[model samples]
Target: MAGNSDPLTPRAKIAVTAGKAVAAASRAAGRGSGSVIGGRVALKLDPDLLARLAQNLDVVLVSATNGKTTTTRLIAEALRAAGPVVSNALGANMPAGITSALAGGSEARYGVIEVDEKYLAGVARDTDPKCIALLNLSRDQLDRAAETRMLAENWREGLAGSKAVIVANADDPLVVWAASSSANVIWVAAGQMWKDDAWSCPSCGGVMQRPGDDWFCGECGFRRPTPSWALSGDHVLDPHGSAWPIHLQLPGRANKANAASSAAVAAVFGVPPQVALERMYQVQAVAGRYDVVQFQGRDLRLLLAKNPAGWLETFSLIDPPPTPVILSVNARGADGTDTSWLWDVDYTRLTGHPICVIGDRKLDLAVRLEVANQQFQVCENLDQAVQLCPPGRIEVIANYTAFQDLRRRVGN
Candidate 1:
């Protein structure tokens, strides 16, 4: 009587082998279930599968171009302050991935997932979260995202009908204004990044001027206001002294914004303001995101920049240590959808130093590095980059997907 509980004996293996082969042959013949969950052949399940699953949970969906992972993790932590929780901690965010993750928690009281922008509307319809967190949007992969406007457009459409109590970023007019239409919006603001919210309006195609920290259209009069949950600059802590006391284990302005957005959302979730401030102060830099590690006995800070804002933010956090740098990029999907954003990054900060540029796209990155006329060591592969870097610790900034993959290979 072999079943899930019984250990597989040799005879059991011999018996199950036939069934496994039958399923495999059927799958190879295009007539079997694509995947197995709960011991069922599940190739062509109905679209309402997620709805069926979520009937048992209080789902929370988080989506944004930046800070979704960190913010979602912390929000789940705070939410657990409310009750039992289940989530996709490894970040498989596609609808299928969410379905896979949501499958395991038939008994959990709550579910929180970070959904990609492309899949948010579909997931929202299926999961029907009672609470939603919308972080700010910025230019990321124009090739895949098409353009900033399209990404924004998709978000607006996804969030249009949600009855969830929305936790939104006020500083970003795009997120704030889109979510503002919700009946009960929980506003969140970070310290002002633009001294003025002035900009060229993507809507109505007009010029925008900052009237205080909020933006107002000079022509069409489309306005973006601040959020309901915000931290006074006084609570944030940074030696750079920008009025906010935000402490990033990884230093930079964009990180401050990330932390602020996370904090503001935490407040709306019912984490008291003081406790939210304390928890944010406790934020540790995820490896490769301004991660400081010891490499070859040298102190190395790893900053991964996948977009224009990420690159700009990494530059802000560069309180470089004694060892120089290993600025790496790659042709891998993780490096970027397109490397054009590299042009927007100010790489002049590394000029005149002996820097190493490593990746499959070394020549491409070298071309960008050369424009600054910086003397750098170029390696087309990771083994070579690690070889050239001195025995002492150093700082490394990687872009896009290459950040985590490169650091895991090099840091050890």
Candidate 2:
């Protein structure tokens, strides 16, 4: 994504300077969203800052309901092997965050951005990315992001007009519907574990039939597109049928899928699959998702689960049976105010495992666990939750703010 290959106007330069000043002050004051506010101010002043900065740059945009941040990080790391690559390090994925990241890296020629699912269309319009990676879509922040089908429609409308090549998940019906009309498209069979949001076909509104991994709409005859890239067991299969084993430091089948999706995107930019997979192993953590930190003689493995789909994936990452787990929930603004999504998750999966529920919304989670017939204890403090777990290492699964708070408290 590059602008018109023209110099910035005098007004835009001043706006950038003023915005950076405010961002500096905000950071000095310990405010987390310094980049967000800084970008907002710059956009308000210049209005065309994104389009201006994007001119003459090779840009890749990544967006999805889940795994976007990690996928963006992987793609960014792969691009770094070629040249300077600028990307939003923080998970702030809106237009403002993208603007702030681009503003901070004025010297970089390559830009890799994690665009929010809702803002993908608008941001893509401004940046005009060279390649757009569309990950799986699921229900998230219902209060904030209205509905899943609507978001899919918006993505379809936005991407249909872009000249960029699209790399999308063929397993996700919603992603297939959104990118089907794109001029250039490469589909990847990155596994889709969460099928709750895609039960109804976005194409015909008919109940989708998924006898196995493939899904098709009986009403409209829309079927899962044939994927050029697929995952065979633990390896990623390329279009030529060559399989590459993806060794990621991050644990989980979900992350393996992310690596496969990212490798397909890197290939679009001429990066070899072997090279991309090699660079991905260097990424040990994204923000604070899979970080393991020590707290009061206990090792805490931090995992974030903001919604039902996230919770489902995270549950699979933790060890089964013997290992104890901590569940943290918060109804803060960063996490949607409604904690009802908790009920949607099949917490019964925890069956015989020992669980410690902790956070502002711990009681809500405790109640849900009780109904699921799973026994759990409630501890509002992280330290106490850590003590409740067995010695050595314990897993801490938390939502947005709760996870951030755990990271801060443990100094991770």
RMSD of each: 7.9, 1.5
lDDT of 2 by residue, 287-393 (tens): 98899887797777899988888889998989777688899999988788888888899998888778999999899999999999997899869888777776557
Question: How would you encode candidate 1's per-residue C-alpha lDDT over 58-94 as one tens digit per residue?
Answer: 7778887766766666656655655666776656577
| lDDT, model 1, position 78 | 53
Q: What is the lDDT of residue 310 in candidate 1?
A: 58
- Lowest-lDDT window of 10 residues in candidate 2? 1-10
**Where does candidate 2 stray beyond 4 Å?**
1-6
Q: What TM-score, computed on C-alpha atoms, does each candidate reach?
A: 0.78, 0.97
- Assess the local accuracy of residue 179 in candidate 1 as a C-alpha lDDT between 0 and 100: 76
